[model samples]
Target: MSLDQPAPPAGQDDSTGREFTSALEDDDVLRAEHVSKRFGAVTALVDVNLHLRKGEILGLIGDNGAGKSTLLKILCGFQRPDAGRLIVNGEEVQLRSVDHARALGVDAVYQDLALINQLSVYHNMFLKREKVHWPLLANRGMRRAARNYLDEMGVNIPSVDAQVASLSGGQRQAIAIARTVYSEAKILLLDEPLAAMGVKEAAIIMELVRDLKRRREVSMIIIAHNYGQVLEVCDRVNLLQHGEITLDKQSKDTSVQELNDIVVEEYRRALEQRQRAAS
Candidate 1:
């Protein structure tokens, strides 16, 4: 749904005509209720419920097989849940495909970035949906739009015509993000956006994220392994454990030590379970 559309309560808009803005001050733009998914005999998610509020960054953190990617894929419409419903802007929706999710103002930037190395920055910006003038791609119009978008996002690059392969890692990441936001994405899913970056480069991405939050135009869900970075950038953090969200807390309400304690306790429980089975 477009961010500008007035939000109504899940069932109220049809009956009482109440606005969604009146639902809650921290309105949930997206919600996954009792979502579950499985592959073969393996359960990937189990009744996982999550909510992303408007204009806030939510951090999804967990160990390697903690179902973070699985849930992210479901949210991005790359995979459908075996059970449960997806609510977008207070209405239930069945996302048919990635394009459907994008049309609903949902987009994701995976770790690979999906950028064509040989393509120029401007070309990549307008990759999927290029501006067309009659029978030709409007190169000039696209270039101008790309420049303005990059500038608006505070991304510093030498030239929009430069090949992505020639840019630094941080610059490439920024360009990928700019392209997504330029497409009018309201809920952005970012998978490890700060991975494999130097201190300064990571800082650049963090600052950009902070700026995005300040703009309050897009809500975000960032997947990262770094707890410190998650606390620094996200307003709230959700820890996925055993295929479900076991921890959800405001960044300020939780600390690194507390987060570590939870992981340690989980480890101990697993060890005890294994010992009991062996006995």
Candidate 2:
């Protein structure tokens, strides 16, 4: 159903609503159904069902240790779920590895960024996928391409020849995102893209995100702690709690205060459980 539409009446089995949701699923670029994951005694995820619509930005928010990262890893094929099906572009397929996911037009950008500090910005942009001319490295071609791509994406950097370590965090982050987008990733997973960034830097990334959304070219799922920013940039938001998604709503229908209250309630319940166990 479109986020702008009103929800169906509770306890009412509206056949029309069902059909609408089904049709919406058909438009989803990515979906995880009944996905579960465990690490020995730790259950990282449980029956998680999430979907990313085409050309949409979905904000995923949760408290620390709430399995948000685990879910992202599963979606990006960095980790596999013990049970469930992953649907990409309406096809259910098992992702074997990160490369396999990337081959399917899915890519993830983690906070670490995985960029080499010693490498020049242009070199880092084409890391591991550098262009070559016979036996010689295509330095000139790569530099030109990287500079052009950055300019096209409106990401500002001092120079493509500058070392990555010399740039600010926002610039580096922008480089990482631009590289992924340039790689033709249709479904992008961003893990804490705004974390630890200053206001100006965060603003740059936020603007970039909005621009991407405006283009309506790629679907994105962003994991963030800032509810305000999420509401500002995302089309929809999902709340993860205790290894499951408990809330999914359009960003316009929710507020930062409402999200904060729900999270605080979860904390209160957890604390009560601990007291009961101790007693």
Candidate 3:
């Protein structure tokens, strides 16, 4: 039973291969165990266990009703899990609020690319953390800091004074990402971020992701429609079906066809098992 929740964001209307084997050797960032949720008679998730490691990407994929967003809401502290728990950085903690997630160094970026339309790049940069003097916002200080942050990330935005509404899709994406990282987000969750972007733009985003991981200070979970994109950036892939994780494989060991075949077979087996049970 599917609930009447809002739809997920558009996924790459314009457009991974290998090399994820050793990107993550001994790093673990976020861990979820046996997590489940339900609304009335509809069960959104069940027995979902996933581990996201530091300095590498983890991919989450499944068909539409497979509860990807539901799981994300739970992780982002928008919704509470009806069962199981999460362990962060080896510590058992309850994410009772979004603040809890933020406190735990976790941050999520939506496909909408949340940014203030009327605000300049510099204002958006510091946002709530803008430098202030005598209870007044110090514009000069914030612009200087924004410039430094963009330079630090190797992102070349034209001007911090430009409003987000005026930026292109890709540039807006870059700004949003820069803001998240600048805000001290340690664990970043990107939800279909590349959707609606062109190939060149998408490549830029991917490169930025790689740069962030190379910095080794932030871990990320990237959600994409194509297995190739996931395989390209993710150290590991975790596939979900009917609320359960059906496939958890290292990107180095599996091909996209193999991933699809596993899902198809698992589905076929489920049908057969149900028929036998009915008989």
Candidate 4:
């Protein structure tokens, strides 16, 4: 954003009024302002403010219990914040449930994938929202749609009719993502999508993510432990620590080594603080 360009009026879009994927062109599709959440006496988040651009992928990184999961749950409508607001497409909206978030084009694919191993790829793709044609189900239509969607997205799988259990880890991950994409989700929250995959499988998933980003089909928030991979795939990266976002930088502006050093230093400082408090 240029200093001379001036700011958009309060709660109003600028004169551009166009949508595009480039960091230079797109508008913020999602915003969380002064968000806070707590579990019992534990504070999970503290006045956190974050935003997702219309077509960029945002990487979320944090150590355990750093409020990452809590924020994700709130964004997905699996949980609500004790304070602050969630703005979608510039409108302040309350997410009543996961279904409500989905209706507003926000969806999440957790690490578990939420897929039934016994079900076929196509079956899982159209789960809960199946197509019908009067007396019988539109199995043929669904199969075709699933196959085409996967193909278009460059997700390689042997057959749409094949059981998900029979597919490789990468294929299964692709299926999970494809299901969300097919649902027409505009913003996708992918929690640890690359977890527990071998190099080849991880590469495949990375390619799939790149393909999605290339197409500008959706804005994404990806939580991952691999800082290198996150930097490789995301447009911007944010670090959550002590229930707040402590660092935010464009991927092009930072490196994995730098990020790691920052995290390590933070951990050292925290350890010293704890030791001092104990004394």
Candidate 5:
């Protein structure tokens, strides 16, 4: 956005045009307005405004060095955008640290579950944030909560006492997802979550994403390099190029080719813009 570019018409939200029914008329869980991030002489993001709707799975995709991770990091409070507003739930907020984001009910589950393999499902799920008490830990209570949460998520695991190391690949993935959901994770950012699973396991993860979307409070942002995964899980796709948003398309109306074209074209346009600025 530039000074010459006219402002968005007063009182109208930009996200409403997408019309995601699961999202309220004004439900923008995450919003980055005119954001810019820089590292020394490098500008990682510039003039970016992205909105994640409630209960909608937004696919954040880009080629290498396209600032996908950087943008996500900004949202996660790992990095701060030097020149924009960080808004959550329509309020201008400052993401001072990673803990700040987590406290606000924004959690990110990376490709790795950050789980301890030697531990049982219940132990892993309640690892650091346990239901603790003086003199004795609440083991039974934690296991009960784990079991109930898994059942609510429609996941069938043999027992919460089973070691995570013994679970199948898909079951392990589910365990990670299940843990996040139980943590009151209202906004979930999944980084390449489905890239490493087998066919059945991957399908399970995909179904879980869809199932989570039914709730009005749980919005998801799934990052994937694979176009097929984006098409399958995303309600909308945000394509970035050299730290700027090049395309934002609804998954239903946008094709894979369009995403590819936008990616290529944005790179080309970026090169052209750089050449012109240099000249």
Candidate 6:
């Protein structure tokens, strides 16, 4: 398969016998080229290529241990790729740290949310970049700004003064994402934003994501297991398999059944390999 075209879906032949063109354009906000990573004896990624277009939501899905989190970490500069190049806004650059990535308008909101339960919502929003009045912290200013930003993002938290521990799972997740946006991150990497939440809570976050998409002020790469939600919010979808992106298609061009089938086929192949090794 050509680098410009993704491999056909598992079990499906390339009947057209023609290469599919890449969706990437000059407007791509981020791009990863032949990225590879290894730890000790294990390989996390191999020759991975992916891109995020400006003002677009790209869904990344894969089975557990498929190196999805590793890719996100590399993209956000939490970890570095042993090989390959990372490009931001058409410029190839090396990210020395998470702060460096943030400085370049790239940031990630991991599943952990990274908020302090003991801190108030406003405090968590301004975690390390807190405003200070030289001798004392600017508590009132932060509270007001936090409230306004949340309201603008359509996040409905009870109060900016409320402790993060007192909020529900979904509420906490929203605050995490809101805080990232408030920091002026133009490229957001969301690692399982809807991981463990009730239906209503998940809907709240789904709507928040949709609102962000509507604004078109930021580009996002969302790592999600829920195929339905992925299709609902993303403009495009990419499937990572065996440490490489194997399928790239617009969400409207694919279905949940197709994605599930591909994943199930991967599971079957792994089982067969293990059985053969035992023999």
lDDT of each: 0.89, 0.91, 0.81, 0.88, 0.82, 0.91
Tell me the tens digit of each residue's lDDT in model 1 across 1-279: 456667555766667533333354337889898999999999999999899998889999988898998899899898999999998877789999989999999988877998999999999988888999979999999999999889888899999999999999999999988888888899999989999998999999999888877884799999998899999999999999979999999999998888888988999999999999999
Better of 3 and 5 by TM-score: 3
lDDT of 5 by residue, 1-279 (tens): 224545456555556443333234366788887889889998889888888977788998988877777788888787888989887876778899877898888877766777788999999887767888776879999999999989988888999999898888788878888887788889988877887788878888888888887753589888888888898789899888778887788899898888877777877998999999999
Residue-level lDDT tens digits of model 6 in 1-279: 334567577555545432223332667899999999999899999999998998999999998888999999999999999999998987889989999999999999997999999999999999988999988899999999999999988888999999999999999999999999889899999999999999999999988888887784789999999999999999999999979999999999999999999999989998999999999
lDDT for each residue of candidate 3 in 102-216, tens digit (9 for 90 to 100): 7888877776766889999989877756789978899998899998999888888899888888988888888888987888898988877787999999899999998898885
Predicted model with the maximum TM-score: 2
* Pick by TM-score: 2 or 6, better one: 2
- Model 2 regions more than 4 Å off: 1-20
When superposed on Cα atoms, how far off is each prediction in RMSD?
A: 5.2, 4.2, 12.0, 5.1, 6.2, 6.1
* Superior by lDDT: candidate 3 or candidate 4: 4
Model 5 ranges with Cα > 4 A deviation: 1-25, 40-42, 264-279
Query: What lDDT is reached at residue 240 by model 5?
Result: 81
- Summed backbone clashes in each candidate are 2, 0, 4, 0, 0, 0
Which pairs of residues have clashing backbones in candidate 1?
A: 7-20, 8-20
- For model 1, give the 10-residue run with minimal summed lDDT: 17-26
Alpha-carbon runs more than 4 Å astray in model 3: 1-27, 263-279
Per-residue lDDT over 68-157 for candidate 2, one digit per residue giving the tens place of the 0 to 100 score: 989999888999999999989888889999989999999989869989999999999998779999798899999999999999998989
Ranking by lDDT: 2, 6, 1, 4, 5, 3
Worst 10 residues of 3 by lDDT: 14-23
When summed lDDT is taken over every stretch of 10 residues in candidate 2, the lowest stretch is 11-20
Better of 1 and 6 by TM-score: 6
Residues 76-178, model 4: lDDT tens digits: 9999999999988777899999999999999988778889999899999998778989777799999999999999888889999999999988888889999
